[model samples]
Target: MKILIAEYAGFCFGVKRAIETAYYEIEKNSGRKIYMLGEIIHNPQVISDLSKKGVNIIEEEELDKLTEGDKLIIRSHGVSKKLYDFLAKKGIEVIDVTCPFVKKVQDIVYEHYHKGYSIIIVGDRNHPEVRGVNGWCDDTAYVVNSIEEAHKLPKLEKACAVAQTTLIGRYWEDILEVIKLKVKDLVFFNTICDATQKRQGSAEQLSKKVDVMFVIGGKHSSNTQKLKKICEKNCKNTFHIEDAKELTLEMVKDREIIGITAGASTPDYVIEEVIKKIRFLKGEKEEE
Candidate 1:
């Protein structure tokens, strides 16, 4: 048996910057209390690791529970203008970690919305990042995750488009192509993260060359889910898991070559553990 890992796996630059910023503040503040606006990233393990370090996470429902002077840290997904203003009015010290790539999407959505172009967001509607993007344009933009959903959309003023930062680049392009043909004066921007494009492209190539595909990352990680989607499209025997416990001999049973890829939020350590598990499984099969 063999294991092949994608060349581009694990944390991208944005996630790394956010995690570093939060960890640095945690160590520097010592006794001070800090609260994240949301899950720092969608990775459950990373959030658990930070929680043990005394970082408190708060969502919209928890806003009223905040006390004066408690520090507020924005997550990398970015937030709506209303949320930012609301936090500002609370007089809390804000530590913003919104990814620059995501921030650009927010601006694009807000600007086009105010300009009166009906907006179309091409990504998962329920995703916090997409929700945040929509929050800026509320009544003007419609969120559609796929062509099927887009088909139900009503014709609006000339449409302007933006995508969730983690959207697969090709998918975004295809959706944009559809919108262009649907709207008379359509305008679109490719706000998908370059890192996501590179990662998916690499994963697709790796998947075609391997027998079993192991996609590693947290279940809630959007980018990680996308990685699994890409891998499974090329390799039917793809498995998505966060840690080594989920991997077993049965999953790798008849495969001589295995490919491994991880979501953007996944750490290098997680991928290493998966690799180690595959090697152990291979050894067990050889012994049998």
Candidate 2:
């Protein structure tokens, strides 16, 4: 069996920066308590490594428990404006590691919202990044993830649209086109991250050439799920796995070629392990 790994797999610039920043802050203030609002990134392995290093992951409800001098790291997914304000009001030292691409979407929403333009975000509403962007617009922005949702929106006199940084490019275009038809005066910004586009594009192309495809990343990761969906469209045998341990021999037994792609937050070691497991499985079958 042949294994084809994607050219654009593993950590992206933003995720890399966030992880590095977390480590730097942890080391810089060894005695102070450090907490992250959520997982610094979506990968379990990375989060586990950080937790072993004394970093604590706290939920939103735990915010009030924090006191002055406590350091809170804003995750790469960013947070709502209200959350930021609340953290400041509580006097917790905030180390913002929000991805620049996500920050750009927030800034754009804030600017257009204040200028009397209705904000429309083309992505999953429940996603942390989308929720953060919505917060900047006072939770008034319309979050649409599909062409169906876009069509349901009421006609607007003025509006500005921005996509979640990890949204698939084709899905964004499809939703945007529907929004354009509904809004009289629309300003659209393609806020999808460049890395995301390349990753999705590469996954799609690779899936077409392989008999089975494995998309590796955290199950909760939006981008990783998007990659799985993209690959599924081209290769029906696509499987989404968080790690190599989830792989079964039945998934690989008859496939002549396998393609592997990972999300931005996936670590190199996880990808390597998955590849190794597949090779071992193939070798054992050959010996049989």
Candidate 3:
């Protein structure tokens, strides 16, 4: 049996920055109460590990519980302007770890909305990143994730559109074409992260050459789900799993070639563990 891995597997720069910053803050301020706005990234294992080390996860509703001098670390997904202002008013120390790409989308939405342009976001409406981006425009942006959703939009004279950072590339193109027809004057920004495009491209290429494909990441991660969907189209035997413990002997027994790809939030150690487990299942030695 042979194992092949995607060239761009594991955490992207944004996730790395967020996790590293979170750990640093935790250690640097050992006595102060630390709270994360949400899961630092979407990975449960990463969240759990940090929680064990003393970082507390809280939602928007729980902000009132915080007092002055408390440290609140914003996740990579970011928060709305309203939340930031509220924290500032409460005198809480805010550590913003929002991805630079996500911050760019918020800036574009804020700038375009003030110029009297109707804002539209192409992404999952419920995603935290999309929600935070909408907040910049006061939550009035039209959010759509599919071509059908785009068609359902009312005709507009002028509008500006931006995409969620982790959205699939082909979905963005398909939806953008439909959006162009619905608006007379349209301004669009391709806000999808460059790393996302590379990861999807590599997964697609690797899936085509292997018998079975494994996509690793948190189950709730949007980027991981997109990777699974992309790989599934090319290889029907694709599996989406969080870690090596989810792998079964039956899944690999008859497979001659296996391809592995992970979401941007996945850590390198998790990927290495999966590879090691697969090797063990094949009766290979540690050196091999």
TM-score of each: 0.94, 0.96, 0.98
Candidate 1 vs candidate 2: the TM-score winner is 2
Best candidate (score: TM-score): 3
Q: Rank the candidates by lDDT, best first.
A: 3, 2, 1
Model 3 pairs in collision: none
- The deviation in Å at residue 76 for candidate 1 is 1.2
Give each model's whole-structure lDDT: 0.86, 0.93, 0.94
User: Candidate 3 on 1-288: residue-level lDDT in tens?
Assistant: 989999998899999999999999989999777999888799999999999989999999989999999999999998899888999999999999999999999999999999999999999999999999999999999999999999999999999999999999999999999999999999999999999999999999999999999999999999999999999999999999999999888888889999999999999999999999899888784634
Mind giving the per-residue lDDT tens digits that candidate 1 earns over 63-137? 988877889889988877788788788887889998889988988888888888888999988888887888788
Colliding residue pairs in candidate 1? none
Q: What is the Å distance of residue 108 in model 1 from its true position?
A: 1.1
**What local lDDT score does residue 201 receive in model 3, on the 0 to 100 scale?**
95
Per-residue lDDT over 93-138 for candidate 2, one digit per residue giving the tens place of the 0 to 100 score: 9999999999999999999999999999999999889988999989
Per-residue lDDT of 205 in model 2? 93
lDDT of 2: 0.93
**Runs of candidate 3 exceeding 4 Å displacement:** 286-288
lDDT: worst 10-residue window of model 2? 279-288
